[model samples]
Target: MESQVTNNANALRLFFTDDVFVVEDKSVQIVLPAVTEAVSATVSIPKVEAKEAVVVVENTVIPAEKPLPPSESYAQKGEILPIVEEPLQPKAFKFLGGNKKSVLILVNDAAYDVSTEQGRELLRKIVKAVDLATPDFALLNYANYKGTTYAELHQFFKPQIMLSFGVEASHLQLNLNWAGEIIVHETTRIIFAPNLHPLDSDLSAKKSLWGNLQKIK
Candidate 1:
């Protein structure tokens, strides 16, 4: 009790008196929460890949099928690759019927197989309807010869009467804006009509074509 009271009296004296103060050096200890197992919160992001754009084409013609050449390395040292040139295709107008009366019948269906029996039968009917025979007029598929001119046709067939089916005068390089339904260019009497295939079933078209046919020559 005596020592306690004495120590308290010294402390009070030091506080009251203008004495030199001293600070004690000590390390600070922080009390944190108890260590626990961490919960996983990993977010996964999916990888995106790029794709090629698609294109659409109309009246697309697939190239002719040919066998692939030998896979030899053409890149040789001190050697040159051979330059290949495609052969020029011949432009001959192949017709079905004989042009006996200097009459021309033009069709625009090259894809259509005219060599078949059905095709021949249909052609026979068409010619008969026009009051002509197979040998009387030249049946030319002008679609095969796309850019044929009036002068070229005239020189080739020497036609006095031309009946165009599913083909325009502009296609034959004829500027016949002034000409009526039945055109009289030079000596050739031209009549532009619908395709022959449709005329077989279309009564109205057949009547109209028949009427127009009489007007030409």
Candidate 2:
């Protein structure tokens, strides 16, 4: 009912002017012409086609990787295992003399073959000067028996006098720095000197060794 009243008020505004005041007798009448037929509007919409989805698959082959064998399997493949070196067996003490007088003579000469008669000629002369022979003392090459301890030598040779040449007391496992000195250790007279191979031409060293040898005897 309120909407109807609003529509009627809008219609009255179109007929009345703001500046003019009209009396009932001076009012003008307006009539709008009507159409004989009613008109209708029609809208057309376009149609879209529906499509099915396509999928592609590929067939690929991957080779399997061979696995590694255990450490023991190496032997089956003709491959040797890592060489674990055994502890160096204590070398059997090889001496040139009979050691009748319990005198141990040591020399370090890897270059010269002391086993030969000509090679040991200098050693023969040195022993002869001290009034000794091959049978009187044990001649040992320190080069061959490098890691031999003092206890091992003492047990084997039972040396009363150890005349070492070209080797130090420490080489025999004796910790003393008694090189070029004559000292009695455990009743064994030890004299360390330069290599006798060079002493053939060294007169002063030979004289000094001889002087020490006399006291030991």
Candidate 3:
């Protein structure tokens, strides 16, 4: 009991002594950034660069299709151009899907759905004539692609060749010979094919069209 009293007295003395440490109740201040200031400081967005000046392409005619040379014996064969080796049945047939540039387009005004039997047949011949599989091609309608200029199209698709089917499709923008002649409207090389209406039964037209397609590549 006496020792407890002594310890208490010692603690009291220490508290009163000037050498002992003392703590003050001082308030601390904290600063926070405003929402707008935080956002401006933290976030950054990039701007898109403007497009280059447009190219004014004067109408330059593509080289005319030459007569079929000696090696291609398919020219002399009967005007009937058969797509497949064996007989083709009427079941669902699809011949499209391939790498780009093989055909930037196969524009037509007829709106012939290639999903149908007759359309499939024509597409087969067209694909075969180019010596490319159906997958490696693209099809367009004149009505749809009228807005984009030829130079923009060339810059984007950079097609190795362009094939236009039917008169309206060819004449829409491309100044081509309407007689199913393969011609160039400008710097781009194009194949101006006959309208699908007459080409359905006309084997001679198919032969001639197929003959012209061989010139591409």
Best by TM-score: 2
lDDT by residue (121-187, candidate 1, tens digit) is: 6567657766787788888887788787877888788899888777787888888862336778999
Ranking by TM-score: 2, 1, 3
Residue 99 of candidate 3: its Cα lDDT?
39
lDDT of 3 by residue, 6-28 (tens): 45777888667777667674575
As for candidate 3, its clashing pairs are 97-135, 97-136, 98-135, 98-136
Better of 1 and 3 by TM-score: 1
lDDT per residue (tens digit) for residues 124-181 in model 2: 7768877898789988888887778877788778899998888787777787877456
Tell me model 3's lDDT, rounded to 2 decimals.
Answer: 0.59
Candidate number achieving the greatest lDDT relative to the actual structure: 2
After superposing candidate 2, which stretches have Cα over 4 Å from the reference?
Answer: 1-91, 115-119
Every candidate's lDDT: 0.74, 0.77, 0.59
Cα lDDT for residue 93, candidate 1:
78
